[model samples]
Target: MTLKQALNRTREIFVANNIADARLESELLLRHTLNISQTQLYIDINQELSPEQEKAFWHLVKRRLNGEPTVYITGHREFYGLDFYVDPNVLIPRPESELLVEKALKLAQHQPGVTIAEIGTGCGAIAISLALNLPQAKIYATDISAPALKVARANCQKHGVLNRVRLLLGDMLDSLPQPVDLIVANLPYVKESELLAQFPVSSEPRLALNGGPDGLERIRQLCRQLNGKLRPEGYLLLEIGQGQETAVTTFLSNLLPSAEIEVTPDLSGIDRVVSLHLT
Candidate 1:
């Protein structure tokens, strides 16, 4: 079959199977299979697929049909318009987390030679995006999993931000060598009980999604460590899950009663990010 025919067939199968964005995903899988860009695929739409090419494409389609994420299958995810390398070892970067990057950039933009720390940097999307945007800032990207750091490191090299964004291996703030002017994070905030139901089974690392019995376990632990790690007047921006606004902001209030705490909602109007500014 021709490339266009193969794409049409895969899209139909995906639609029938109830996959969202079936056409887009089908195109992505096809491009990945042929190792070609979208332009090449369309330009060669009428060309017939080699027997081996058709076989390889079908293999990828089967994987997507069985519940593997397209990003994991293709090994690419875009955040802040930048491509990132992701795998099961690291949580796939989501659009909502871009708020953390934006808030961090804003908080750091005015501070000369600002220093920033991104806890749970995962694939290093947030840290790298920040590094590319704010060249004057020095970023520290930390993760508890060495494998996850491996992915982050690759992305840093891909983006050529390895010199600006340092990859650290440790839990939360422990890897931070000194106080930073801005602290940003997209930590795992899904309740441990909800993780299994919310995400595909074994599709992602448990360590990247688990937040204890309640969703705030890891957030709380990080909040406890913020005392000495943040420079005076530093800002903390966090990307949190839904229904976690009140509890998280309250905890921060009690911990630092004088600090100004604000919550920013995502495009859907759900409270998605909580930012704290220290005086």
Candidate 2:
């Protein structure tokens, strides 16, 4: 089949299954299968796909049809303009989480040699991105799941930031070697009730999604642990779920009543990042 024909068929299949962004997904799968660039694909749109390429493309399509995420199938994702290896072991990085990276970057820029810790550093996207952007920053990244850390470590190495990023295996800040100037986390915030009612993606790791009854358990735990882990005048950046602005803000206020707090919304106008500055 020709490239155009394959994409058309794949998109039709995805659309029939109610997958959003079918055209984009189909194109990505086709590019991965053909090992071709977007420009190359367009240039070769009318060219016939080799048998091997066609077979591989259809295999990936089948996986997508089975409800697997494209990032898992492609084994990579782009975050902060950098590509990171990803799989089912780690939660796929989303564009919304970039806000956390943005906030961290802005904070680190003003503090030379800023020490930072990333809680639940799945795929090491945030930590590595910060390390790349802030070359002088020392970053400690921790993940409860060793498998997720493995992915994160690989990404750190791939991005040439392994030397700057210390990967730790522990929950929250328990494994950090010392307090840091900043702490950033994209912890699991999906409520158990939400998981029970309707899980977002079954293929994703539940440990990376479940956040107790109200989706704020892990956030609360981190807040309680920030007392000594974060340096005086340090900052904490957190990526939260939609509509969680008020709850997370209130919880942090109660924990550190005098700390300065701000909520930054994503492009969709959802409260996606919560920034807290210690007194």
Candidate 3:
């Protein structure tokens, strides 16, 4: 069938299934199937698609309709203006999370050559972006799953920062060799009860999202373990879920009430990052 015909049919299917961003989804699927860019799609609107290509496009559409994330289907995502490979093994890099990287970049400006560690590196987007932007910084990244670490390693190489970012396989701070100048984490902070009720858990890895009973389990653990893992004058920049700011900050206060804590919001104005500078 012609590209135009295939695109129209795919749009209909997506709309009928109530898929979000149906038109954009159809365009991306068509682009992937035809191995062309959006501009090329218009140029080749009349070109015909092979049967194999048609089959592949339909498969992707079916997966999307089944609630699978488009990023996972495409095996790629763009974050902080850099492209990274993604899959079911890792949480898709998100725009909101870019704020965390931005905050880190600004903080790194004054502390060049500082050692940094990223807990739950997943696709290594944060660590790699920091290493790329902060050329003098050394970063260590960790993920509990080996598959996730493999993807992160490839991404580190893709960004040409493999030499600066070390990928490890373990949970939290256990994988790090020593306390770092900064500890940046986007670890799971979602509560157990809210996992199924609010977010798209079907396509994401659960271990990467579940934050235990109160959702502060990992963060609390990180705070306690961080004393031994962080430099005396260093700090921790963490990404927290919506409504988690007060809880996390309050918990941190209970641990180190004398510490300076600040909450920074993302572009959407949600309290997304918790910045803790040691006193």
List lDDT for all candidates, in order.
0.92, 0.91, 0.87
Better of 2 and 3 by lDDT: 2
lDDT of 1 by residue, 1-279 (tens): 998999899989999998989999999999998899989988999999999999999999999888898999999999999999999889988898888888887778887699999999999999999999998988999999999999999999999998989999998999899999999988889999888789854588888889999988999999999988998888999888999999999999999999999999998899999999999
lDDT of 3 by residue, 51-168 (tens): 8988898888888888888888888798999989999999888899999888888888778788989998899999999998888888999888899999999998888988889888
Where does candidate 2 stray beyond 4 Å? Answer: 196-201
Candidate 2 structure quality by residue, lDDT tens digits, 229-264:
999999999999989999999989988999999999
Two-way TM-score contest, 1 vs 3, winner: 1
**Pairs of residues at least 3 apart in sequence or in different chains that clash in candidate 2:** none
How many pairs of residues in model 2 come into backbone collision? 0
Rate residue 87 of model 3 by lDDT.
91
Scanning candidate 1 in windows of ten residues, the lowest lDDT window is: 195-204
lDDT, residue 47, model 3: 86
lDDT head-to-head 1 vs 3, winner: 1
Clashes of 3: 1
Cα TM-score per model: 0.97, 0.97, 0.95
